[model samples]
Target chain A: MRVALHLAYNGTHFFGSQTQKETSKTVLGELENVLKKLGIEQKVVASGRTDKGVHATMQVCHIDLPPYWDDMEKLKKVLNKMLCDALHVKKIIHVKDDFHARYSAKKRSYRYIITTKQKNPFESDFVTFLEDVNLQQIQQNIGLFVGEHDFRQFMKTGSDVKSTTRIIYRAFAYQHKDYIVLYFEANGFLRSQIRLMVGALLTLTKDAIQAQLNGTKKYKIKPAPPNGLYLSKIKY
Target chain B: MRVALHLAYNGTHFFGSQTQKETSKTVLGELENVLKKLGIEQKVVASGRTDKGVHATMQVCHIDLPPYWDDMEKLKKVLNKMLCDALHVKKIIHVKDDFHARYSAKKRSYRYIITTKQKNPFESDFVTFLEDVNLQQIQQNIGLFVGEHDFRQFMKTGSDVKSTTRIIYRAFAYQHKDYIVLYFEANGFLRSQIRLMVGALLTLTKDAIQAQLNGTKKYKIKPAPPNGLYLSKIKY
Candidate 1:
């Protein structure tokens, strides 16, 4: 039986979303370990791969399991209990054998959180901190990323993708709680795409503030830390 | 000179709030060690002690330091940078020679968080989880500890408190996001008092539900996990 699951993880401890070497701790590695412990042998197929230390509120994945393991709610609880902390399979639902986790997904959304307000010790692992943030200017320039464009400038170098062009369904920066969150929904994101875009937006915001401070303006874009990036949603 | 500080700690890694054995990781031990490295020698006195795995958002303490340490903000930044994480001195303020953290004459407040909703991996260490939660019944019984009461039953056994009678200034349970929080303001609480009270309240809530369901009432009281308890505020 093929099963699709919605996963949520802190990602602070895991190496990344994809399964790499045996010694490395990855999300898929943990999943397979837990499944083996439960007497099920399977390989998991995920909708996308997130970089190291990146979190997910909603990541989709598929796995093949024994047909006898049909109680999804109970299975979810058992998996969460066995996995204990860090990585979790939040929901378990049966899927068609032909349905794939990656190819069947239509859109994905990622949110990047930056806070000028004080972040507590428990939350320090999840938010990016900055001294100055110009919200109004970020609001004005955020739409520049809404249409389809070559995001090669916003991608981490050494990543090979067939196309540098990707459609941006939505891109906006807004205040959430004490943090500024930039939400990006697109058909797909390149390697470290959302983080690089957030970095660029933060630079632009800083540049706007610098332009106000002095006559000259500057732009420097580097990817924000993976801690603040969340794979929030996937629209299939 | 005596210096008072506003302290915050995640407490997940520390053994406890007190400095015990020479090699233990504790809040005071960490503070004194950092101070020693910075060329200041002082024994700290805290307003109260927290048990293992407990957290504090606003703990008060006093310590004697080299009289030259007058710059509060810089000292605070250095301490935070040096301490790195887990435990921190949030604010550093000078106090009179006679001021003491423990002997200060005022109220203290603690909050216990209970969740029927899902707690994330990052937050699972800070909240108590239960299956069945009846909010209205718990709300109705929350004022049981509002006034002075003999809380001997609530205290963990073998604790050597001088008095079991303490004034409870306020006690109530309120909804915060997806969790129910029981807040207690008091002159002082016996060891494990707040956690035990929450446990009793939860049992009572379960009994009330059972009474409604099967027409049988029951009561069970046990100390809740230390993770869910937070020493939120101290007043002087």
Candidate 2:
């Protein structure tokens, strides 16, 4: 039986969503371990990778499990019992064998949360803090990257990607009390694309710096910390 | 120079507000170390004590410093610089030598956060999760705690205190989406009094349990986790 599971996790402690040979704290590693504990020898596939310290509220994944796992209710209860405090299995739905987690039909959305001026001890792990920002200016110009554009300058270093052009269906930044949330949705994202873009946006909010991308060179403003980024939703 | 400092801290990592001979991680231990580094060797005092795993948004304390430490602005910066992420010094105000953090205090306020059904990864460290709850009933009966009452029935074990009668100014619980916040204000609190009261309130909301009292005997409903409680304010 093929099952799709909607999951959420706090990425601060995990290396990332992908499995690594050296650590079992990654999202996939935890999930796979729970699967093994349940007496099921199946491989789990995630929709995409979330960088270390990046949270996820609605990430989707698929797995081929034993026929006994067909009972969605029982499986969720078992998984939740084992994974409650960290990773969560939000929902489970049956899917055709051909449905792929990464390639399956649609868009992905992400959010980056930023708090300004002072650090909140309670929110330190989940929000990035920046000072002296002109949030109004950033919000006004945030739509510049809404359509198709070459995001080569925004991609992180070390990944030799063949293509740099990607279409951003929607993008915006808004304020919620002291926290500013930036939202972006696209067919897919290049590694570290949103963080770099958010970093640039943050820089744009200050008078001291400007975003420089004349042709196709690397942009200033290092990618925002992964702690503030969240893979919020994946739509089919 | 007698100076009072308003402070806040994510107490998850601290032993408590007061220092202990064994652990150096108590809130006062950290504050005292920083004071020592600054060359102010006077004794430090706090408004009250908060247990391990508890948080404080507005804790108060007083320290008799050298006359040179009268520059309130500079002292706050120094203290905050030294105490960065775990603890924060919000404000520093000079006070008379007779003022005391514990005795001269007028009232203290606390907040208890409860997250129902699902465990939110971001708030796991700060909130307690309850499965079945009647928030309405909890709120309706919350006022039962207001005014003066003998909280001896709700006090924790092993604290040989003389008085059990305390005046509560306010007490209530309200829902905010999936989260419920319980508030309490009083002249002062007995060790774990608020938590035991909250625990009894939670049980009272349910159909099966009752808060029993038989002429100064122990009551039911285990104290709620310290993680969910926050010392929000203090009045001088």
Candidate 3:
């Protein structure tokens, strides 16, 4: 039986979402290890692979459990106890065998947070503090990223994907207390895409406002720092 | 002339509050290096030392600047730009030669935050998340920590403090959103004192009715996990 698990994890301790030979500290590897210990086969697939130090609020994954274990209630309890504090299973539901974690997903949502205040000792890990950001210009420039566009200029140069075109269903920036949150939703994301986009937005807000205002093709944009980006939700 | 500079630092990247022989990553060492580069000969003095993985909201420090650099406004700007991102100068005031950051401070306050919900990826570094806790019980038990008490039982085993009797002006636990913030104020604190108190409170709250009914003798407690505790505010 295939079980879909909605989960969340603190990516600070993990070496990204995918498993690596040198460092098996990824979230997927840890979940697989726990499943194996429970006498389940190591057949787990995730909705997406987040970069190192990136966090997710609702990441979906599917794992095959033995047919004999019928009680999902008991299984969830066992898995919760076995997993480390950094990883948590929010919900588990038995799904059809045809259910796929990655390919079946329709949309993904991400939120990137940046702070303008001095370093908050309390929220240091989750937010990127950019003291010199120009809030008005950044808010104005974020509208440029709302529609579908060839995002080759906003993605990492070495991304293996064949297509640079992506449909950005939504893109907006807002303030939440001491932090500014940039929301983006799309069918899929390129490697280092969100970070690069956030960086570019921040650069536009900070340095290249005049060029962006003039709609000039010749301009340079820097990506925002990585610590603030988060995978907030995934829809299937 | 010696001037006391009150500062705050996010200690996640720091080795500790004190300077070490091998690694100059301590808060004191960083400040001293910046002072040296700015041609300041004054030695920096801190109120107390904070452990690795700990943080400070308002830690007090004293440093002497050259006579030529007597302008406080310019000094603040220069120091602010010189310090690393993790370290910040909250305030820089010129004090009398006899004033000391350590000895002149009248009271110190520390706050430890623990969350009852699942771990927040955004708050991984700042707050500690415990699975389930009885807040009402913890609030009631905190009353026992107020006033002067020989906190030998709450002190860490190897703490090298000469006096265990300290006046706790405030000790209370309150809830904000999904988090419980425990605030403690005292003339001084022993090593790992706040963590130990929080640990004891957690144990007490786990069995609320019993703890509330029991007297002071039952207050012997464990140290709360270190990461959640912060040197929140220092009142001098």
Q: What TM-score fits each model? A: 0.76, 0.78, 0.82
Better of 2 and 3 by lDDT: 2
Candidate 3, residues A64-176: lDDT per residue as tens digits? Answer: 87788788888877888888767888889988889999988889999998888877444555688776776676788777776667676666667777787778888888888
The whole-model C-alpha lDDT of candidate 3 against the native structure comes to 0.78
Q: lDDT order of candidates, best first?
A: 2, 1, 3
- Pull out the clashing pairs in model 1: none
For residue B13, give model 2's deviation from the true position in Å. 5.9
Q: Which model, 1 or 3, shows the larger lDDT?
A: 1
Select the stronger candidate by lDDT from 1 and 2.
2
Off by over 4 Å in 2: A12-15, A19-26, A33-37, A41-43, A103-106, A115-126, A136-170, A174-179, A204-220, B12-44, B77-87, B115-119, B122-126, B135-181, B204-220
B4-89 per-residue lDDT for model 3 (tens digits): 77777777768889988888799889888888898875568998888887888888888766789888878877877887767778
Residue A128, candidate 2: alpha-carbon lDDT: 88
Shares of reference contacts reproduced by the candidates, in order, are 0.41, 0.50, 0.19
- Report the number of the highest-DockQ candidate: 2
Q: TM-score: which is higher, 1 or 3?
A: 3
Those runs of model 3 whose alpha carbons end farther than 4 Å from true positions after fitting are A33-44, A68-70, A82-84, A117-119, A131-143, A146-148, A175-179, A204-219, B11-15, B22-25, B33-43, B73-75, B78-85, B131-143, B174-179, B204-221
Which of the numbered candidates is closest to the native, going by highest lDDT? 2
Where does model 1 exceed 4 Å of error?
A12-30, A77-90, A103-106, A139-170, A176-178, A204-222, B12-38, B41-43, B77-90, B103-106, B118-126, B135-179, B186-191, B204-222
lDDT of each: 0.82, 0.83, 0.78
Task: Tell me model 1's lDDT, rounded to 2 decimals.
Answer: 0.82
